[model samples]
Target: MTSEEPGDSSVVRRDRFSGGPARGFLSSLAADERIFEADLAVDRAHVVMLAERGIVDGETAGAILAALDDVEAAGHGALPDGEDVHEAVESAVIARVGPDGGRMHTARSRNDEVAACIRYRLREDALSVVEATLALREALAETAAAHVETTMPGYTHLQPAQPTTVAHHLLSYEAAVARDTARLLDAYGRINRSPLGAAAFAGTPFDVDRERTAELLGFEGVLGNSMDASSARDFLAETLSALATHAVTLSGLAEDLVVFSNRGYVDLSDDYSSTSSIMPQKKNPDTLELVRACAGDAVGDLAALLTTLKGLPRAYNRDLQRAHRHAFDAADVVGEATAVAAGAVRTATWNEGALAAAAGEGFSTATGVADLLAMAGVPFRTAHEIVAAAAPDVEDGDDPATVAAKLDAAAEGVLGENLRTHVNRDDLEAALDPARSAESRDSAGGPASPAVAAQLDAAADRIDADAEALTAGRDALAAAADRLETEVDRRV
Candidate 1:
């Protein structure tokens, strides 16, 4: 305020407008920290491209690049106030290199520059989410491999449906998370494209090499349409949608663990648990409860973001500035939640005996019994009816002799034949054993130990492939950084 320059106008405007109170509301500088480094990199690439195209002299490009290095070292906090990071960065450069610094903005506009910066920063965030999800899948697969035979009750509608192993349950989640990871990676493909050189939606008059800038910045390619390049925020929306879906998966896992802990079928380690303020015996899974609630926040963010963009006209609006934070916030929320879920799953301990005991409760083995009768030449519906009749007399796995007697009597009414006419009594007794019932399920992806082993092998192969893909992505980003620095060194 003390300087000769008017606070209301920027370096580019040079005091054309008067100061007002609404400057605070209009300025996005205070909340632009996430894109600070990205803005620097994009600015650097654009400057180099301008020099190579003879839009600016080589010496001037070197000086501007040198000034940018100082600005970066001084850090974002030292930036002079402006409407956004792009202006703040330009102002800093002009201050360092004097009049020659103005050459850096020759063929660019804030529209294209901000779009490029958002993509540069968001690609990293998207990759981080992918890495966290892959780690969670690895944890699930590892835990499941160790418990291929650990029997548990699988439920539908919160009631015991059948006997299944812990491996089967955990691997089911692994499959769900794998699909989420795929969505994130697919979104990353779209997010990494360069939007630089578009120059205010219509593109630059100066013969700028869009592909050269993209190469320097690690973008897979340039966004072909200048209007779409600068105006499109669909990639942002897609990323948030992917994260919200993953958060739903995370909530389901949290719900299952919470219910399992409640039923004494699992115990979360102390690292992931909490005690009540007043109740002495309370060991609550508070971390998981919070994780379950994170899904709502993610969904809310997605809704707000989409609502903000519902009817805006194309090609870079100021509203875009307000929209990015929703995507950024959702990505952060889901990323942290994914890591917490992975840790909780890895550290948890399953109660085998309790799970097994609960597996056979409430005639959970009724399906297995019905299957046995159907295999014995009785119509499948007749078998189902006979098993339902026997269910009221005794639990399927509790009293084998009582269940057998009831089944034969029920058969007399339903089929007019004894149960032993088809299946031997030994086979009848074996079918009533929950553990034996699980063992006999040798179908692909069944609860049997052998089937679970096949699933483990498939899961390992997938985790390895995803880990390699993530590593390749990180390597590409690192290589781009190195290439940009080397080229900058040549210019400086």
Candidate 2:
């Protein structure tokens, strides 16, 4: 080992130095400024709580608050020359108050402080994720509304099965996104509880006002126990899980868009597609593919986080720090990817002719035939058997009108009721194609023009409500931040 220099802390070990090609540290680059901001919030509350509890002098608490306000004004708190976030903060306080800033840290440990910081950051980021989710929902809703009556082939087993409205298909994703939004909200609720009082794996001897700190910082409540607070990374893990789930959901939608954009099914907007560099004629749905790829990244992050935390026997460990990058990176990936998907949906185009043609080629109205037979008073199962036996003989590629005619004449003596009245034989043969059939279904959630219109109206209302809620939540957080800053200033 090299001799220790006058100011050197330790000799650099050659074994560790040459262990492998050293990667430059970007760990600190992932430092969530929101987390640092949260730390400031916690500090403001902590000083006030200390003063109220008589653990620290009024002047010391007051000075600490003022120093914090100054730190905020400067856009950073007391970070140290060679330390991490916690030490940096305390160092700033001492610089401002001539050693009194050091007292504010008395009852707390870095463990609890770090936990609170993460919670605050998670709360802030979760809201954005929710907003992105809502935006995606609205985009799908808009697409659904515009294409409600536009007919498309509904597939089962990758084969055209029936005619369904494009609006109906789009609404299916809206329903999915709504659930994702709810999941995020649930995750936010869990994230709201504060861990500030946990104090490094055990309760502190000091009579700390953890509840007061929690309230001052706008946390829902103090964590029930100290050890659990310091040791629990569940909040971080849970937030990532929510993000992963949303990513998976978005990926599913992206897959559909990719398939739809291929080979004349749906014409994706030029902005969302790209020409292959080598292929002379290729409009690749590269953007959609990216969204799908991002979902895989989100999933990997989720698994990586869980793996990082799984075997650690911990109140706190350096290894736990590794979890931060995945969480932060996944959040960014999800936010940006969701935004891209929303924009694509807003600008995408569909091929009405292609969709209608595809819908008609595979006896798309077979189910409707069964539906009509049931309506004519034959029990559905019997009607199904009768239709099933007659179906193969119904002529391949026959349109709904021809099928209706064959059914009507075949069942003339058996099932009673002018089937022709309910189904147009002549017009159904010529103009009443699958595209029109999709327009005719008007039941709730159906692809009928009127039903699709109703769905669009409902989706609009839901989108407005979700957007308002998100705005209000953000405003509340901002207000809390402002109030905390102001209160600290008053004390200083």
Candidate 3:
């Protein structure tokens, strides 16, 4: 071991080494700044656990804990020159309380300590993303409720295929967001597990209470296998996977709104849109465009994380330090995208009159007429043929009577009888109306008004349950922090 300076009180004993370009290249202080508080909490918890287990004397534990508090109060700028935040913090503590401060690292390695810090901070980050997902879900469901009767043309292959209400379309996205929220909560289960006692990838010889540290850190439980706990990054990969899928869902929704805005079916709120730099008449959906682009960014982050973790043979490697950066990028990007999408959905205005007018264009109600004919004793295939025959004669402004006359002529040639003989004009006219056509679809999970209302109610209940779950998780963490702090105060 070598000391860096002669007669320097703050010099830390370490193996002989040269510090130059390689030190700056390997330093993680920039990224580790995000988890500085988490590192301090882990130190306090570990020291308290050591004292309770008789692994360290009360006097040393108290001095170390007090020094940790001082180190934290000094802020990031006061951290010493080191390869990572863990070393910097430990160096600060030793500088403050002399050799007694070094006792704080008893029964733990930087491997387990850094892993615990990542998990502690990631739990809060995952919860925040879940909260944002819930907000978007609430916005979608409420918007659907308000538009239950707002009729519009539903598209397939970007062509008008049938009539559907705005509520039904909006509710589709709400259902997707509900599933996204569920996936994130499921991923949290793995993220909340603690890896505190897996010191240097093997069981510690010291009598350490892993569960005590886990409880103090608000973890659901300790990761059972020491080696796996020290090196496992699957939890981070799973979180990024969930976030990436959610970003895809948001991208699809953004694309739909962009298409709708382009087609004059809906108008976006000005705040979510932007004006082109050179074009005077352009109102671009720039926020949604960015949300759409976030899918690629999130996917890239997940891929990068997996690539970094792949082919690693062991319990702990320096490469693991690079993994958390990708996770942080994914979480931050998706969280912001989710918030912007919620705002866009909440403030958007639908052009109800324009939607109603366009709902019947391109022979969109032809399927309703065929179904009506099928219900009135006409063979479904024969009804299809009859409608196909009359489609050429149907004009944009043709009235129901004119359309009925064409259907009759086509039926006479196809079935040897007029369509009016089987179905009266009143029935044909009702089937030809797009609004009635949409209402006629009363099947379960259909786009009818009543069906959409039921869906909205169910989505609202799910949102409430998820919101409560998030609150409970957050409160549990807060209680654990309070308990840990209280224990620290009593010991020190």
Candidate 4:
């Protein structure tokens, strides 16, 4: 070991190489603000566990914990300059109680401690994302519930392809977001496991009770292997991946809203829109455009995290320090984007006339026409060909009279028979009408009023289930916090 730097009070016990350029290079105090409270909680749990295990006396453990309370009150900004939050906190504790404060680090390593702190903090972040996702789904369902039969254009490759109700359009996005919520909640299960007692990547001889600390910290359980507990950052990667995917979902939702806003089919609230600096007539979907662009940042953050973790050896490394900003940044941005999306959906207005008119343009009901022909004894492909050929001559695809006349003419040319030979004019007219066409395709999960109403009910059930789960997770953590405080009081 090298010489100890006794003059600098900020430096913890390990002082072989201090005050070098590498010291500043290796510091993580700035990036550690998010985990400060987490570190304090982990310290309290570990100190309580150490006293219980007879590794330290109740007097020292209580003193260290009390000093920790002082350190926490001082806040991360007031922390002494150290290599990281862990060292700075330990140093602060030592300042309060002298060498006895050093006992708080007993039977634990920065390796396991940092892991535990990250998991503790990240579990809350994951749950927050879940909450945001459910909120967005609720907004979608509310808007959809109100417009179950409001006919709108559905598109393929951004070109109008069919007439669907506004409810169907919004519910599709809700379904995607519900899945994103599940992914985040599932990841939370993995993140809430404790890594605390895995001292420096190996078990210590002090008989440390990992599960006791885990329980105090609200972890579902302790990691089974000390080495794995100390080294694993896979939880971080999985969480970033989930957040990035949800960002992509939000991007798609944002894209649709941006496009609809441009088409005059939708108009977002002024709170979610911005006016152009020079163009007096312009109301830009700036929030949505940023949300759409956030996908790239989310993807980049995930990529950076995964790349940093690549090809590392089994234990903790200095490189791991660089990985957390990615997850933290992604979590914060994705949650904000999700909430903004929820607000935008809840407050936006839809143009019923524009949506209805656009819903019928571009031969949108031709598929329903073909389906009608098929039902009336014509081969489906033959019906499709008839409609495809007739579309060019019809002056207005939405006009049933004109579409029927063109289809009859095209059928005579294609099969030497009028479409009237297969289906009656009344049936043809219903098939060509956009409103009737939307209602006609009333299979399960379809765009019809009854189908969308069924979907709304289902969406309500899912939101309830997810909200209950969210509340359970939060309640469990709050209870754990109470238990931890009780333990601290007994020792103090």
User: Which prediction has the highest TM-score against the true structure?
Assistant: 4
C-alpha TM-scores of all predictions: 0.97, 0.84, 0.94, 0.97
Model 2 spans > 4 angstroms off: 1-34, 66-83, 95-98, 311-314, 389-432, 439-443
**What shift in Å separates residue 365 of candidate 4 from its native position after superposition?**
0.6
Candidate 1 off by > 4 Å = 1-8, 12-18
**Scored by Cα lDDT, where does model 3 land?**
0.89
lDDT score at residue 208, model 4, on the 0-100 scale: 83
lDDT string, candidate 4, 1-492, tens digits: 113322373455454676667777888989899999999999999999989989999888888888888888889998878889999888788777887777888888999999999999999999999999999999999999888878998899887788999999999999999999999998999999998988889789889888899899999998999999999999999999999999999999999999999999998999999998999898999999999988999999999999999999989888998888899899999999999999999999999999888888888888998999899888999999999999887654336777788898999988899888999999888877788899988899999888888899999999999999999999999999999999998877
Candidate 2, 324-412: lDDT as tens digits: 66877888899889999998888888888888777766666666666665775667886666556556657656655567666666555
Q: What are the per-residue Cα lDDT tens digits for candidate 1 across 19-67? A: 4687678788878989999999998898888888999999999999999
Please, what is the whole-model Cα lDDT of each candidate in the order they appear?
Answer: 0.89, 0.75, 0.89, 0.89
- Candidate 2: residue pairs that collide: 78-88, 78-92, 79-88, 80-88, 441-448
Worst 10 residues of 2 by lDDT: 5-14
Cα deviation of 110 in candidate 2 (Å)?
Answer: 1.2
Candidate no. 3 TM-score: 0.94
lDDT of 3 by residue, 123-160 (tens): 89999999999999988888888899999999999888
